[model samples]
Structure formats: structure tokens, C-alpha cells
Target chain A: MSGGYPKGRIRREDLISAAAVVYGEAGYHGGSLREIAKRAGISHAGLLYHFPTKEALLAAVLERRDAEDADREQLGVPPGLEVLRRFLTLAEHNARHPGIVDLYSRLAAEAVTPGHPAHEYFERHYRDARHRVRDSLRVLADTGELRPGVDPDEAALAFIALMDGLQVQWLTTPSEVDLAGALRGFLQTLLTVPLQP
Target chain B: MSGGYPKGRIRREDLISAAAVVYGEAGYHGGSLREIAKRAGISHAGLLYHFPTKEALLAAVLERRDAEDADREQLGVPPGLEVLRRFLTLAEHNARHPGIVDLYSRLAAEAVTPGHPAHEYFERHYRDARHRVRDSLRVLADTGELRPGVDPDEAALAFIALMDGLQVQWLTTPSEVDLAGALRGFLQTLLTVPLQP
Candidate 1:
């Protein structure tokens, strides 16, 4: 369908986008593979040819989201306060993309159940997110940008929590909650240096 | 059956408990009244008699939780740093009751979809929660217990987000996340005095 793009690859991408919307609205538990296939304009058997199970499709969906976010934010580049700033920029990006935010928030909550298909995915995702945030905090601590007496690990956990928790509130009441502003306030309290770069 | 409790009232309570269990595990969209009825040892029609719709049952479940928390914490009493202390205590209680926490986190995330039955309920719930937290912060500010330059409203939002976000992380990896400790650390940064009362 496209220059140098295979038809199968395009179909797989279509399925992932459709799955994201279905899962975003009804959640994984409420969403069904049949519905996802319907949205993707494919036969159920054809969808199965690509993803043998709903769980497999979910894994792909999650991976695609992370890869896209990483590419957009330059996730690991220029680590330190810069990484934290990238997160603020990401939060701003999230404000404009409520669908992705909804999908993430819904799935993360649903995945807390021990045996949910995506439980392990979210567990690892958060662990990685925490590590990234903590790594940035450690860099700031070494550079004297972090305030005195702040624990890097604890601050890392808190910062991740703030970003996640703020999304839920912002989604519910968009007019009242300012996602990046709250994050900036929390960062300002934790850092001795200016965040404006 | 022996006490003065009426059969109808007891049946209603039983249905509510069963509905909570079903809705907690499967969320409102994925949960069914028939299953809830079966769990309560009643017919579907009987369950419907008590909770006209699934949405009605969800409302009852949410209200019961808030009523229980309010009763336990004396929500409006003291009205200052003491209110904040009650929240810390509530967080401790939530750690011991992961089921309630799971139910809440799941429902809150699900309710973010506009037109979700619990949408308005959560909107009002968060509004009330923010006002309560902000009211306490205002009290602390009046007495100079709050750190200088901290905005009460912003701090209140961050605190709520922290607690909500921490619960998700704690639920996912209970061994890694310390719910109350992170919260206390955040409060320590905002307040001049110890929260050990």
C-alpha cells in the first residue's frame, strides 16, 4: 500500500492502533479480540494469524507505545536534569493526547490484578520508569542541583507517582488540573537550580 | 437472622458486598449483575430489585467506601494538620486493605472516560478531596506550619496524586513500594513539624 512498505506490516500496525482504542475505552477485560479485529477491518482468523492471542497483541501494543515515546523524547539522551525536563515535556505532550493517557491509566490499573495478561508488562514498565527517574535524580544529586537531604530513590518514586496520579485527575477534570504545572512545582521544591533551559 | 436486622436490609448488604467483589475484580464495564447475584446467593431479579442498574450498584459501592473511610477517619473533625494526619492514617489503612485500594484505583481510572457511570461521581469525589486537603493546608499556612513559598492548592493536588499513584505502584509490586513512607517523606518536605502525632 505504501512505497517499500509491505501489506502485512501495514495490517499489523492497523491492528495495534485499533486495539489501543478498544482497550482504552473498555479496558483489556472489557475489550475483545473480535471487536479489535472488526475495528482493524480484518477477519478474526487473519488477526489471529498475526497475534495468536489477545495477550500477545497487548504486548505489542504496549511495546509500540514505549518505542514511540522513547523516540519522541530521546528517552536516554543527555541524562540528568535534562531527562527530568524531557519528562515535563512528555507530560505536556500527554495533555494533548488524552487517548493514549486514558489507555495507559486504564491498563495500568487493570494490570494490578496478579493474573491479568498485562500484569508483568506493567510491573516491568514501572520498574524501568522508576529506574530512569531515579537515575536522573542521582545525576542531579552528584551535580549539586538536587536540594540537600533529598533521597534520590524516594524522590524518584514520588516523581513517578505524581506524573501518573496527575494524569488520572487531569483526565477526569481537564479544566482544573494542570499536568505540567504540578510536576514543575514538585520539581521546583526538590531542586535548587532553575528548570528553565 | 437472629438479631433485629430485617431480612431485606441484610439481603441488601449482602448484594452490595458481592457486587463490590465482582466490580472490584472486573470493573463496572466487565462485571455483571447475574454473577453478582449468584455470589450473593440470590436471583438476578432479586439483585436488580436492590440496585436498579449496574450503575446503581456501582454508586452504592462507591458511597459505602467513602462512608466507611469518613467514619473511620472522622473526616471533618479537627480540620487542619489533623485532617492531613487522618489522611496519612487512611493511607496506612489502605495498605492493609489492598482489595479496597484495587477497587478504587480501577474504578477511578475507568471513570475517567466521559459517560462512564462513575464519571460525575469521581469528579465530585476529587473536588471534595481537593477541598479537604486544601482546607487543611490553609490551616497549616495560617499557623506557619507549612513551609514558606509552598502554594496550598498545588501542594494539595500533588499530595492527592502522590497517594493515588503510589497505590498503583504498590499494588503492582507490593514488595518495592512503601505507600505511607513516600507520603510521609513528601509531607516532611512541605511541613515544618513532624507528622508523628
Candidate 2:
């Protein structure tokens, strides 16, 4: 993105990054396009040249975040025990990127209204994320990793819930809550059959 | 609060409720005092007469919600595994209150920024909530109800995390997520040495 004279694409990336900060702080409805333009070091019309509408800009921002996350996280990591291990790593990653976390947390909460802009995006994200989690648990359960009577689907949802809940605590009080350690302790209790000494 | 006109307190309650709805929909930064006043069917001056500033109104709304939550949830139902069981019931209650959940979820996310108005409030809330959860786990650990090697503090934080995380998911997609059932499964794994049948 740096070496070439692809000024148009660079301008687009700059706008998206600034928009992420604005939307992260002020929320989608609260954030203004003009503010995003100002933050990105461009005029309002310059921003409009790149992104014709707010909705378009928002979609681009989300798409870029997804791409960045996939590249950073290797989203295709194998399931089962790796999912458990990656849960810790993902929390660690989120801890470093407060801007993305704040943007996501704000949008997800607001999007519960069904007609909100990010509603469909979040609906799909959660459904897919939960499916992967359920598959991972089912894989472990098949190998007798889970204790008797622990439903794979239930464990998957609860594990996801624990991850989300710890994230909220971490975002609010970083020093007091250790997201990975807390999650590890939870996994220890859940997988008591001793995969570890 | 209605008939004879100790209407001052009633007016305050009405304003707070209206503000909650506004904040829940538009978020804290997006919502305006004028809108809250309009929603409450009172003049802007009259609203401010009750609450001198927007921050004052926000504080009042949060305080009232706290009072309502305490009154509704039997926060003193004895500790131990009973605390674990009560977690399920609390989630059930939250399932019915999407307004509070939406308002809380949005505020909690925004408050992650250190300077946000609800920042200190949420920091204190998690600290206190985690401490209570830890104390409850300690009570159970003393009775040998907890599985060996389950750290009381860590388990407490994880349990709290699970509850908060579950609430967010439930609020977003109520039909797919079973808040209570998922919680019960997590607790079963945590207390798996079977102090019960």
C-alpha cells in the first residue's frame, strides 16, 4: 500500500481507518462523515469521491477489518483443541486492538434492532462463529475429550459466551481481568479428564 | 407517586425511564436531552429542573436501573452452588428485559474508554461483581463442592464472564440461544465431582 502511486486506494484505506476510529468512539449513528474526512486529512467532497455514502463507507470498513483479521489470525486454523488454544490467542489479539473491539462491541449491541445497517453482518458472523465452535466441541466430544453428558452444542455456546463476557470485562478494566488466564481456568474445569498435567 | 402529587419523585422516575429508552435506542452520545424530554411529555426546562445536567440524568438513570436490578434479583439467596443455580435464574430474568440489556450493553461497550461517563461505574461494577462471585466460589470450595484445582477467584471471574457474554448473545438472537440451559451445562462441568446425584 505504500510503495506505489495508488493514491486512490491509499485514500480509501485512510478513510476507512479514520472511520473506524470515529465509529468506535461515537457509534455508527453518532459518527459523522465530515468528521471522518477531517480525521483522514481529506475534505468532505474528497471522501465522497471515494465513498458515495455512509452505508458504503461502513461496509468497506467492516470488509477491511474482516480481511485484516483473517490475515492476522489465520481464520482457517483447524478445529478441536486448536480452537480452544486460539481462543486465548484471539483474546490476546483483541486486547491489543481496542479500536476494533470498541467498533465491534458498539455495532453488535446497536444492530440488535433487526433493521440496523450491521444487523445482517452480525447475524451471519455469530451464526458462523457458533457453528465453528460447535463443530470443534463435537470433534472433541467424539474423541472423549468432554466429560459424559456435556452437550457439544451447549458447551460451544457457553464457551463462546465466556469468551465474549471476559472481553467486555477486559475492555472495561484491563488490569483487573486477565482474559486468557480466566479462559484457561474455565477450560481446565470443562476438560477435567486431564489432557494436561 | 401518581394521585395526590408527590409528583416530583414520579416526574424524576418518568424522566429516567424515558432517558433509558432514548439512550437504549440512540446510545448515550447519540441521544439528546430534548428527545428524552419529548418522550417523557415534559418541557425541556422542566426536565432539567429535575436533573440539572445530561450527566446528572445519565447517572440517575443508571442508579435507578441498579436499584431495579437489586430489587428484582434476590442478590442474597445464600452462596455456594446455590449461587451457581441463581445465575441461571438471573439470565432468565434478563431474557425478558431487552431494553435494559440493550441500554446496558451499549453503555458498557462505550464505557470501555477510560474517559467515558460510565467508565468508573462499570470498572467498579465488574470488580464488585467478580469479588462476590469469588466469595461464593470460596464458600463452595470450603465445602469441597468444587472440583480439585479450581481456583475460586479464577472460577468466579469466568462465571461472571460467561453470564455477561451470554446476555449479549441472548439479547441479539433470542430464538437461537438458550441462556439458562447453556449456563446450567457450564456449571455442571465446573462442579463435576458430583456433590449431587
The models' CA-based lDDT, in order, is: 0.91, 0.81
Minimum summed lDDT over a 10-residue window in model 1 chain A is located at: A1-10
lDDT of 2 by residue, A58-160 (tens): 8998888888777877778877777676666776788787777788888877787887888778778777778887887788778888766767777778777
**What residue pairs are clashing in model 1?**
none
Best-fitting candidate, measured by TM-score?
1
How far residue A113's Cα lies from its native spot in candidate 2, in Å, is 1.5
Candidate 1 contains a number of clashing pairs equal to 0
After superposition on all CA atoms, what RMSD does each candidate show versus the true structure? 2.1, 3.0
Give lDDT tens digits, candidate 1, residues B82-190.
Answer: 8888899999999999999999999999999789999999999888888888988899889989989989899999999999999999999999999999998998788
Model 2 bad stretches (over 4 Å):
A1-5, A192-197, B1-5, B192-197
Model 1 docking category: high
- Against the true two-chain complex, what DockQ does each candidate achieve? 0.88, 0.72
**Strongest candidate by lDDT:** 1
lDDT of 1 by residue, A1-197 (tens): 45244888988999999999999999999999999999999999989988999999999999999999999988877659888889998999999999999999999999998899899998998898889888888899999999999998999899999999999999999999999999988988889999886
Candidate 2 CAPRI grade: medium
